[model samples]
Target: MTTTILAIFALVYLGMILGGLPFLQLDRTGVALLGAIALISLDAVSLQDAVAAVHLPTVILLFSFMVVSAQMRLGGFYSWATRGMANLPVSPPWLLGLLILMSGALSAVFSNDIVCLAVAPILAEACIRRQLNPVPFLLGLACAANIGSAATLIGNPQNILIGQTLQLSFAGYLQQAMLPVLLGLAACWAIICWQSRGNWQSSAPLPATPQLRSSDEQALDRWQSLKGLAVAAALLGLFLFSPLPHEQLALTGAGLLLMSRKLHSARMLGLVDWEVLVLFAGLFVVNHALQGTGLPATAVAWLAAQGVQLSEPWTLFGATFVLSNIISNVPAVMLLLPVASHELAGSMLALVSTMAGNLLIVGSIANILVVDAAARHGIQIDWRRHARVGIPVTLATLLICAAIFALRL
Candidate 1:
């Protein structure tokens, strides 16, 4: 049973690293689900044990935050933000700064993927209207969202998992992480601006078009938006002052959002990205079963004997960067989660893995989303084009984060 479980575990994670099983039409989520099903069938884990392995708090917290973000999206909050930011009569550099700041700030509070999903189209249209190159701004949106999500426990899935698993304080993690996040955001802007310098002047006038008005584009319930914002603000405040459980607070906030009249409860709930929740649950059980196999400790010990200690922050950072590019960030986090328990390990793992996404277009789902969205608008952002900026930005930001960690250590 132990050998069978270990074999399944190895194959599952190998699938994760490869982004699917060989020659199979499966994604990471499918691989995870299949692995869990296999474990259950083999009796490596009982149904009850499997149920216990899934972390309900993390799932609830993730679902709740997605609802809050959905409320904001439906309310035209992201559209309002993009238009407002674009209207500023500032130079490209200043505009870039504002984009980074807003993206980071909003992502810290909400899910970064949803932030990108909501903001990217509007940002693209705004850039076209302004006769500015949309590539830099789009890249900035993806990169900033990635960096900003690292600022808070609720900002991204990896951080949420890290926070829930380690029981890290919401406010405390913020205090520890804010400096590096700010520095990383700045690095993102600097790299982008430098790359876009001469090209900004060549931008043609934005073509005029008749389309939906701002009012028409406002798809969300106004009352629901206000309520969601209030709940989110209150949750943040609670994180700062109250000793209440964050998952509980966030779940309450989500419940409040669900009680909206203008938005159908079913539609709002439907937008919660249930597949991602399932992926997390499936991976949790698989990883838990793998942990029981004792391979993690044995692997760690073997590495240590060879002078390749993963517990060291730098070693972990490099490993995370490479693994993230290969497997994508979320699955990379799942693979590394078992061994990442150091005081600053979560922060290191989160920062490096997130930043590493910038190295290649495939390194993060956010980048892929941006590229695909651009293609719908007849724009192409191939890997080479992305890597020109992405590679440097990723390396520079990773170095800055590593420096921050080293200084604190």
Candidate 2:
């Protein structure tokens, strides 16, 4: 049973790293779901155990925010913001600064993935319309989103998980994370702007803008956008001050958003990324099953004996940076959750995992979403193109975060 579970874990994470199994039409979510099902089918974990393994609060919180993001997307809030920024009449560098600032700030409150998904294509079009190169702006969107998401526990899925599991204070985490996130956002803009110095316009004529069926392209509905913004603002207030459980409060906000008369429930709920939720559920069960086998504990003990204590902040930070790039941030955080019982553990995990996503296109779902959104708009951001900016920005941001976190400690 142990061996089988281990094998399943290995295969599933392998699929995560590669994005799929060779010759198989499975994505990371599918691979994870399959692994969970396999464990139940083989009696490695009982159905009840599998269900219990999933952290319900984390799932609910993630779902609620996705609904909120969907509401804003349907209201065409993101598209409005993108167009508004593009026409600001500022110089290219200043426009770039505003783009990074807007992307980072929005992502700090909403889901980073959703922010990138909604903004990327429209940004591509706006850049093309202005006869500016879209590559730096697109990369900036993903980087800023990732960096800014680190500022709040609710900003990204992984941070939500770390917060819930560790029961960290929302305000406290914010206080610890804000400086690093700001510094990282600034570093991202500088790096991208510098890399884009010689080429602000494509040599060839801009390809026809791909038809985007994104929520950003939806007609801007002021009332709906305001409604979403109001809810988001109120929720953030509750998060900062109220004693209510974050999940319950977030869920309540989602339900309120669902009650709108004009926006059909189906359209709002349809925008939820059920696949991402499934991925979280599947990984929870798989990781739980592996934990039951006692290998993780034994390995941690062994590492400690060898003077490699993972509970220490620096060790965990290094491991998180490496694993996040390998298996992506969510799963990497799951793997490291065992040793993350330190006082600073939650913030360290959140910072490293979130910032590391800029290392490669596969490093974070935000990066993938940005790339996918751009591709749909007929813009190509190959790995090399992304790496040129991603590598330096990642190193600079990680160093800044490490310095800030160290000071906090």
Please tell me which predicted candidate would have the highest TM-score against the true structure.
2
- Among these predictions, the greatest lDDT belongs to 2
TM-score of each: 0.93, 0.97
Q: Candidate 1's residue-wise lDDT over 110-214, tens digit each?
A: 877888877877777777777788889888988898889888988888888888888888878898889988998998999999899888753554444325344
Candidate 2 ranges with C-alpha deviation above 4 Å: 209-216
Q: What is the alpha-carbon lDDT for the whole of candidate 1? A: 0.83
lDDT of 2 by residue, 1-409 (tens): 8999999999999998999899999999999999999999999999999999999999999999999999899998999999899988887878889999999999999889899888887888888788888888899999999999999998999999999999999999998888889888888888877877878787767777656664548889999999999999999999999999999999999999999999999999899999999999999999999999999999899999999999999999999999999888999999999899889999999999999999988888889888987787778899998898899999999999888777878
Tell me the deviation in Å of residue 331 in model 1: 2.5
lDDT of 2: 0.91
Per-residue error at 29 for model 2, in Å? 0.7
Question: Model 1 reaches what TM-score against the true structure?
Answer: 0.93
Clashing pairs in 2: none
